[model samples]
Target: MSIQDYPSRLSDPKSRKTETFSYLPSMTDEQIKAQVQYIINKGWNPAIEHSEPENAFSYYWYMWKLPMFGETNADTVLAEVQNCIKANPSNHVRLIGYDNFAQSQGANMLIKRGDM
Candidate 1:
């Protein structure tokens, strides 16, 4: 996958918060997502899809920046996603926008990422 496809897969700007990565110097979107997915794969499920909008960022925050290389938080979840991407970078690196209600290949990437 090309570098251009990285951001959208890493985040849905229309709904996901952008500010979390603003201060994380040097991390590409791909790396950030690898971090998040690895976290998810480890079993630390963040507060997913909460009803109150304000609480949403908490989930986003967890997904966006947990699991850095030397982080105290790094563990199985981050390792799993990192391994998947390392195993197949081209397959895991692309994103096609799709909401949960819609069914399509775009959603498959998340499934493939173990994010869904």
Candidate 2:
């Protein structure tokens, strides 16, 4: 067996990291608005959270604020996401749909990537 016969190493530093919707291209503002609408239609409370790139996968993410309970407007939720990104430009921002009945997260996705 020679090096030529072996496949390249699997450890590539340039490889992109994986997370929710990582496989898909970055979402646009319109696309994000659509998703927010879907969450509201599902009666899920929208919430924002952010974390440093290093802690992106940590169990605990810093909540932007209390979930927008009884929120019927998608724009309001999207605004909060923007606020979170502005406050934490160097951190990853995500939106979560909380199901009060299920008492857990029903949907989640990364809306912004950190500069670092």
Question: Which parts of model 1 are misplaced by more than 4 Å?
Answer: 1-73, 93-116
What C-alpha lDDT do the candidate models reach, one value each? 0.35, 0.83
Model 2 misplaced regions, further than 4 Å: 1-16
Candidate 2 lDDT tens digits, 1-116: 65433232335422445364865689999999998999999999999988887776569899999999989999888888888888888988888899999999898998888865
lDDT of 1 by residue, 80-114 (tens): 54554555443312222222233322221232221
Using TM-score as the measure, the top candidate is 2
Q: What pairs collide in candidate 1?
A: 38-77, 38-78, 39-77, 39-78, 42-77
Q: How good is model 2 by TM-score?
A: 0.84
What alpha-carbon RMSD in Å does predicted model 1 have with respect to the real structure? 15.0
Q: Estimated TM-score per prediction?
A: 0.23, 0.84
Show the lowest summed lDDT stretch of 10 residues, model 1.
Answer: 107-116
How many clashing residue pairs are found in candidate 2?
Answer: 0
